[model samples]
Target: MRAFREDESRRNAPLTAENATRVREAMRGISFAGTPPHWAELIAENNWMDRLHGVGQSSSRS
Candidate 1:
């Protein structure tokens, strides 16, 4: 998930895009209401799913 965070190009992409819609769906009600290093993982993980077309990262950086 952290890997995705570093991939700023994708991370900064609009959440209203199609892929972002899919990401939000997978998140299934997870709130995007918080600060970094906290909501960071949730947003990154969801974004990662969208980026890879459903594939998840094997490891996360700390």
Candidate 2:
């Protein structure tokens, strides 16, 4: 998403110009090792998942 890329670029802002470009490129190329976890797996692992789920549900209604 554009917003995600923008946020990632902003996070690279503290680095030197070359370092920032490298950081952004590295982040853009992210690939999970092994299979990606499912949403239910995420919910089971994280205590904050309930809070996040509620926020997701609320956002969908709006």
Candidate 3:
């Protein structure tokens, strides 16, 4: 998540519109595979069902 935050910061930094778009695209392709380096607390709980089926978590609220 730290990497994602850093990428987000870089994307938001002052830059040409074209450059910003490229950074945004690059960040969109970034993924966190395997075990994370740190055990940071997740803001939302995750279920193994989604992970097993390769489906990402939905943003829907109960």
Give the candidate number with the greatest lDDT: 2
Which residue segments of model 2 deviate by more than 4 Å? Answer: 1-13, 31-62
For model 1, name the residue pairs that clash: none
Find the 10 residues in a row with the least total lDDT in model 2.
Answer: 12-21
**In model 1, how many backbone clashes occur?**
0
The TM-score of predicted model 1 comes to 0.26
lDDT value, residue 12 of candidate 3: 57
| Evaluation by lDDT, superior candidate among 1 and 2 | 2
| Candidate 3 lDDT for residue 41 | 45
Q: Which stretches of candidate 3 lie over 4 Å from their true place?
A: 1-13, 34-62
Better of 1 and 3 by TM-score: 3
The alpha-carbon lDDT assigned to residue 47 of candidate 3 equals: 51
| lDDT for each residue of candidate 2 in 20-47, tens digit (9 for 90 to 100) | 4575588788877986567746555467
- Give me candidate 3's TM-score against the actual structure: 0.33
Please, what is the TM-score per model? 0.26, 0.28, 0.33
lDDT of 2 at 15: 48
* Descending-TM-score candidate ranking: 3, 2, 1
Distance (Å) between predicted and true CA of 36, model 1? 15
